[model samples]
Target: MTDVLVLTERELRAAVSLDLDAVDVVERAFAGLGAGGVVMPPILSMAIEERHAEVDVKTAYVPGLDGFAIKVSPGFFDNPKRGLPSLNGMMIVLSAETGIVQAALLDNGYLTDVRTAAAGAVAARHLAPATVRRAGVLGAGLQAELQIRALALVRTVPEVLVWARDPAKARAYTERMAASLSIPVRVADSPEAVVRGCDVVVTTTPSRTPLIEAGWLHPGLHVTAMGSDAPDKNELAPAVLARADRFVCDRRSQSAVLGELRSAIATGAVPEDWPVDELGEIVAGTKPGRRSADEITVCDLTGTGVQDTAIATHALRVARASGAGHVVEN
Candidate 1:
């Protein structure tokens, strides 16, 4: 018989969150990526154009970890109209030594949400200016608020600016975030406003076209574009990469085909062979990040399989210690 721990979203939430610890855990995973020898593959993705949905499967095997995770995440943009969440999925963790199932994290995308937000904090920690008075976010989805919260973990965000296609959602975001972050939150009239007035900006929308122009990039501005996991999604103009002093990616090869780098390359703003550094290299201290506060920095985070493996491992450990999940023997 094999025992597999099964954790629901509520149990997983009780075990982990968008905190500094979560950020640190993800940071270490990036470092492992930098150190190399981790077996991570390109994401396997499928599109359901009829339903306006995309499902992604990601996994990575780290050298030191005892287990790895295979996560299945789906995003249905039109679900909210039917009173359902746009995002939902789960992670399956297996033993690295024997390839046996260890845990089934039925998080319904909650773990993805936490780890992605933690990655934003990781990017800001390594790349953003030391002092961030204001942080601007381009989406009013749950991630918009979490990104601001994650940014606050690495840098102080006394003011927050948000812009969303739906004015009602933006208003709701501003109100709710102000109370949650205990900082002043305001709705921006345009994406330009969010980028121009803040030292740090994070684009969390799955925008098809460029929402942020290169002209809006100012000195000391750090932009982390986290929404472009697919070839079709782009948040910043391709030229924005050329305008930045330093361009970083979670993974360069993946970014080249799947993230903002793809858009930049497609438009010829950045060369096909542009020299780049991964966030992992920076975290591992093998490469430099944010050489000067006045330098403009852009990080393209399409998300990574390593992040899923790390977070899933952490959640399972916490659940085991806290006795949070049930186990089924088969």
Candidate 2:
């Protein structure tokens, strides 16, 4: 009989928080990827255009880890109108030694959320300015709040500026975030306001068109574009990438197909062979990051399979140690 542990979202949440430790695990995974110690497959994505939904499957095997994770994520943009969350999914952990099923994490996409946010923190830690006074967020959704929380771990951000398509949503986000972060949060009238007012800007919207223009980029501004994980989505103009002093992405190949890098390359703003650095290379110390205080930096994060494996491994470890999940025999 084989025993498999089943962890629910609540139990997983109790075991893991989006803190520095979580960020470290994700950072290590990226470093492993850069060092060629991880085996990650191309993401398998399918679109359900009729429902405005897309599902992605991601997996990676780290050489030294005992287990790997296969994550299935579904995003239905129209779910909110039906009183359902726009995102939901689960992760399956498999033993590296025998490829046996080790655990099933029914996290309801919580682990994905935390790991993606942690990646943002890792990016800011390596690419953002040493001291950040204010940060801006482009979307007033779950990621908008999580990205700021993650950024606080790397830099001292005392204030926030948020902009959303709906002014009411932006105001609500401001009030809620102000209470949560213990910092003043203000609503911005436009995307340009958010970009011009803050030192670090995070774009978290699933915007099809460019929300940030090239002209808005200035010296010392760090932008983390985390929203464009699909081919049909983009948040920054191609010219914005051309203006960056340092352009980095979580992975070059994935970014070319699904991230903002695709749009830049498509528009001829950046060459297909441009020496764009990966966040992993920077984290592994093989490449330089933020060489000057006045340099404009941008990191395009499309999320990765290695991040899923890392977070799932950590969550399972923590859950087992804390006795938070149920075990079943089959």
- Winning model by TM-score: 2
Give stretches of model 1 more than 4 Å off: none
What candidate 2 gets wrong by more than 4 Å, as runs, is: none
After aligning candidate 2 to the native by TM-score, how far in Å is the CA of 82 from where it should be? 3.3
Clashes of each: 0, 0
TM-scores of all predicted structures: 0.97, 0.98
Against the true structure, candidate 1 has what lDDT? 0.93
The C-alpha lDDT values of all candidates are: 0.93, 0.94
- Sliding window of 10 residues with minimal summed lDDT for model 1: 227-236
- Write the residue-wise lDDT of candidate 1 on 1-330 in tens digits: 999999999999999989998999999999999999889988888999999998999999988988999999998999999999988999999999999999999999999999999999999999999998889999998889899999999888789999999999999998999889888999999999989999999999989999999998899999999988888889989999998999999999999888999989999998999998999999999999899979999999989999999999999999999988899997
> Candidate 2 on 159-258: residue-level lDDT in tens?
9999999999999999899888899999999999999888999999989999999999889999999999888899999999999999999999989999
Give me the displacement of residue 244 in model 2, in angstroms.
Answer: 0.6
Tell me which residue pairs clash in candidate 1: none
